[model samples]
Target: MSGNLADGERAGAARPCLEIACDESGSDGENLTGGNTDVFAHASVSLSVTAAAAAVRETRDRIRSPAEEYKANHLLREKHRAVLEWLLATDGPIHGRARVHLMEKTYFVVDRAVSLLLDDPEGAVTLFREGRRTFGEEGWRAFLDAANRLLRVRPNGDPVEIFYGTADSLARAHPGTDAARILERLAATRPRAESYRAGCADGPPLIPVLNPLLPAIVRTAALWSGDGRPVTLVHDRQNMLTPDRIAWIEQTARRAGVGLAGVRLVVARDDARVQVADFLAGIARKIASDELNGRADPALTALLRPYVDPASVWGDARSRALLADPVAG
Candidate 1:
């Protein structure tokens, strides 16, 4: 639980990377006519130290839940439930102690990035444009700091890398493609990254994530992103209990070309597989304690405060529920 992959392997640990890939899809096919939302899944196959096919299956067996199988419909529903509860406690207007704690932690990440980016506004432009730079010298330095901070741990740490899949980075991987274009428009509208990058505020990389094969609603979005780097595909608030749907999403994700994972929460709109409200709410429930008396400590509060609700036409009812929960948090 506390070592890097290499260190764990050296210690003869059981599972190394804990690679979990999750995909989300609907009967409506992930776009356009948005009726009949069918399924979503968090499919994970853990490979063990033996590095054999048998180990792979074993890993899959150990981690695979009835809710984590190829059949995603049921899993999808359950996950949604879990996410909904989380949203209610943490981000709901009323103070859910554990929910606030998670929000505060979440905000730190954005705050750290924004601080670095805003340090030298002019410098950011030159580093990005003039040089075909993958993290310019300054950027690389910042990257190292961010990476270190992100990977570090403490007592009662967040075990899951819940937000691994990044949207801008993903779209950039396949620039000029349909998905990329849609992401571009999303970049303009989505403020997810604004808290982190000043440049993002100008022409943001946080764009609408889409599956290119779905030809139903093809809109022009930002095409150039990530600069063709390896970006992880994060499925937010996924519920995949059905094998058939899970299989379809697995295949679809592969066709799109990116690593995927099942994340409990993410911004609700766009292609983010999960809902941000749900994730925070889930964390609220997970960390809730009678001793805290419904008030998340500074640490817990830090983790949950930053998540803003991403609502569609009707907005999110899930976020409101957290507020109604009894506050022995």
Candidate 2:
């Protein structure tokens, strides 16, 4: 929203607001400690929920990369060690494997966000001091800064928000909180499991503006291979995303201050009112194809459906089937 501004003012102020989310999915790794299974390769995704943008360039960057090491343990070091090392510069209360719990690189994604906006990063720490101090924000800002800088993007004026959740939350939750049932479920699995039922257990949060860090969150929504490597960038490509996915992605776009509807108006004026829905329609058809071919799971595709438009999301099908559904054509 620009108003009463000189030409340069509008140009410089064209920054976007973004709500970012990052989460990692881990499969049951073969190696188990005390019956606890380590997470497999840690993957990350950063999404921008805006009017007419996506991580297509970023996604292609990832896909184009020559297949390389995708192992979690190999890439991620323990956070305690890194933090403690910075704290003491030598041995202290925490040291060695016994003193610290090894964490994956995924844990650092949020911290990256914080470093983006803050100078000394104490800017974030001061905010934490106001709370119970579960964790510091400075580290997150630093990580975020690194990401933005890595992408050669400026941070100022781009509204950014971040959080961590899990696929467990996306799954249907049943009533009757039973500790016994929970314990039993964990015991039944060959590999041990941990659930964050309290934090972000209420389904995936919408981060409309896809920013530098959103890939980390969207990673959770994608389909993972046997080793937890992300197989599909968009989950909705699995079966047939519904109007529901379009509806949600619409919210995400609006929340991020990116105007897909507006973009369609300028670039895709033909039935632009339903461009978002049409884009998603294509994504849904892809998901259906994958399901029939055993390439992806229905649940995963359902999530991707919310992010694409029916008519142009996938963009093709001179010979593809067209649905005579309510909103189509």
Candidate 3:
């Protein structure tokens, strides 16, 4: 595989390729607003097919279900708690080999609205960081709700109309408040809404704003390519990873100095590694969502801690504290 030279490598030397299997849980395509899941998780694992299959077999041996194939739900059952623990244990096959990127769906929509509509991404992030304090909890939720409606692309709706309508409603609802000020700032970027609408119309019809999978894939590639090796992702078949999107991912990663050789799509049932990745992604999503809702199982949360990527796009104070505190229950 070809990639940028690693430190201490000869300039023209070929870089080794690291093949990773990937799958995601809670993908609702661009429907992050009212999707079945509150969290989106993308997982990648650097394990050989044999190793992955062996792990799966081990899980099956412990669970002993009659199903032809196993899935994350099988492991997530209350009766299979020990099996789940064993899978996430440090000595487990997946421990150091897997990484998961989790995105809280609502937080993702808010981030997209801020980054797309505001001039300074950093400033937008800062505004969001202090959003709860600056605006009351109700006001902040109102702002997020507005942002979610504004960014959600509807087939028969005008983007500019949606943008102005949402902004006006939010401003009216929270007049003389920080939320209203943020809405004003967002309204100033009306042209961006028009441009985004035009781009979507001119393209293969993809939601750059609402889809978290695209960024998650790029992050996963970069994480696996840290050694300067080109990463070849063997992913489960996903409609969102179109040819144009894959090309975009590669180009974007290259610009960021990541060596993404390419991505290969395969059927999950046919790929054992991808199946293992599905388990990791699915389990991580469940644990994280539970934590966010204040119904966390301490044992499961502790087991899930290590697999979560540090760059996960979670905005909840509880999630932040859990990730930051090693001894957190």
Expressed as tens digits, the lDDT of each residue in 1-329 for candidate 1 is: 11134543554444322222222233222222122321111111111223323322332353365533222222224344443333334433222211121112212223333334334333333322322234344533333233223322211222112122232554466566543443343345324333333342355222212222111111000010012222232333433223444444444444655332222233234321222222333343333321123543444333332321111011112322332222221
What would the TM-score be for candidate 2 when compared with the true structure? 0.18
The number of the candidate with the highest TM-score is: 3
Clashes of each: 55, 59, 0
Worst ten-residue run, lDDT, model 3?
Answer: 320-329
Worst 10-residue lDDT window, candidate 2:
93-102
Q: Output the lDDT of residue 289, model 1.
A: 25
Q: In order, what lDDT does every prediction score?
A: 0.29, 0.26, 0.80
Ranking the candidates on TM-score from highest down gives 3, 1, 2
Q: Which digits, one per residue and each the tens of the lDDT, describe model 3 over residues 1-329?
A: 11345579777687668899999999986667666999999988888889999999999899999999788999999999999999999898887788888888877877787878775655555556666675667766656665665565654355567557756776676677665677767777878877876776676454367888888998999888876778899999988889989998888889999888898999999999999999999999999989988898998988888777777886665686684333311
Q: Model 3 lDDT vs. the true structure?
A: 0.80
Looking at model 1, report the run of 10 residues with the lowest lDDT sum.
Answer: 216-225
lDDT of 2: 0.26
Best by lDDT: 3
Q: Determine the backbone clash count of candidate 3.
A: 0
Candidate 3 stretches with Cα past 4 Å from truth are: 1-15, 126-146, 155-159, 202-207, 324-329
